[model samples]
Target: ATQGVEENIQEVVGHITEGVCRPLKVRIEQVIVAEPGAVLLYKISNLLKFYHHTISGIFGNSATTLLTTIEEMHLLSKKKYFFNSLSLHASKLMDKVELPPPDLGPSSALNQTLMLLREVLASHDSSVVPLDARQADFVQVLSCVLDPLLQMCTVSASNLGTADMATFMVNSLYMMKTTLALFEFTDRRLEMLQFQIEAHLDTLINEQASYVLTRTGLSYIYNTVQQHKPEQGPLANLPNLDSVALKAAMVQFDRYLSAPDNLLMPQLNFLLSATVK
Candidate 1:
């Protein structure tokens, strides 16, 4: 019955070349698409090839641009993850897709880069390439791209409050995990860089975890105090949390958790709840 429409669709073999006229062949499959506002679904025989194309595109043929875009993406992801807990459409898909080892693209720049490297290693491009040469390029790319992102994330990790630290940690963790792959290069400088990032991650995690727990607990207490006593007086005999300080602290909490940091709660709480949950 649907044969007529099926005939209009496409399924076929495809071929291509790159990095010195090397031929790469692929099998294309039936594509389903919608128009205006639409969704696309495909079952492809060469998903890895598609990933190859995506990586090439994301790189934009320039290392500098790739670095900028990656940092921006990670920052945005961090803000979204920490501030907003809502499950977006893309996240739902991520939940369903099984990523290979290193499981990149949890919205970190390094994650995406590692994923691309994985695909590159599998692709025909890697067939004729020398691992040593490729490894050298990898080190340069990491130094140029990964280093600055780490610096910025480190500053944020150290300077930001509990909520922002949470954002930074999630981002840094993904970056560090992917970055460790660069250890494939055994240069002393690269090794030192790796150790530094590792230490940063460890220190950042401990500090931020402590920060979040303390703040969350305080939030609980504040909510309880406000709920029990909304009057303009000392609710708990805690001088630091007297009316003015309580109001200030509540404001700060809400501000920190606003917008993308909505991971904590959908909205601000007027009463300090009995718990940080």
Candidate 2:
């Protein structure tokens, strides 16, 4: 009879403890999912840590049920913090992103994206990531925020004319590169931006060269040579390469060489990079 009485008491104690912890677990989860910002998550995690330590001290630190609940809540909050912050920025980028203006200057999308980065970087002081993990976290934050913006810019530029598209990309990428330069631990990102800029510059240079060749009347000869095979024996056979056409082309070429600056494409004036112009 005594054994039956003891078992009943233990069952009652177990139900009471579970009842207490169940409400707490629900409340912690609500706080974790509902909280809008990472800063708040850090504060909540710190508070949980304090409570965890206090409980462990009293309960001999043997992973008591309450302590275990607190630890799980702490981890959940952290995971939610990063996920929430990234999702918020990604949604904003999709909504407000825009294309570059006519002058090849930074677009509305680039401005807003840079402002978002500034705000995120400002919050780094309050970050709760451990010292060893901070670098990795920083990289993730940049990739989550910046990579999408880059892709959006690329997509937007696709609708532009060939002459303006590469220039706009260069301008947008240049601003992004400069903004990142003001921050630390972004060497890899800088290198990637630099590489992209160089590639665009190469395209722009090729376009300009083609324009010059066509304007100076040399593209006819250039294309003929490119299309002609060695076996074709191209010297005097082609009517387009006659003496009169050659003289006119040479005159146009000489005129371009004498006043090259005056003959530049007007669109080049809108290019943002002075070094490129």
lDDT per residue for candidate 2 within 1-277, as digits (tens), equals 9999867765665455556687998987887778656556656665676677676665443336767788788777755674476657666766755766878777786787687676565555354445445566568778887888888788778888776888888888888887888776789999999999889888888888888889989898888978888888864588778888888989998998998886676567777777767
Root-mean-square deviation of Cα positions for candidate 1 versus the true structure, in angstroms:
20.4
* RMSD, one per candidate, in order: 20.4, 7.4
> Which digits, one per residue and each the tens of the lDDT, describe model 1 over residues 1-277?
5875543331111111132122221111112111111111111112322444465555434333333333333333223331122123223333333322121113343354445434433332233234664465445434544454444445434554544444344444444444454445535544565566456445545654445535644555545565765565556575555667667666656665674244332112211122211
Model number with the top TM-score: 2
Which parts of model 2 are misplaced by more than 4 Å? 1-78, 95-97, 123-131
Q: Report lDDT per candidate.
A: 0.39, 0.74
Question: TM-score for each prediction?
Answer: 0.29, 0.69
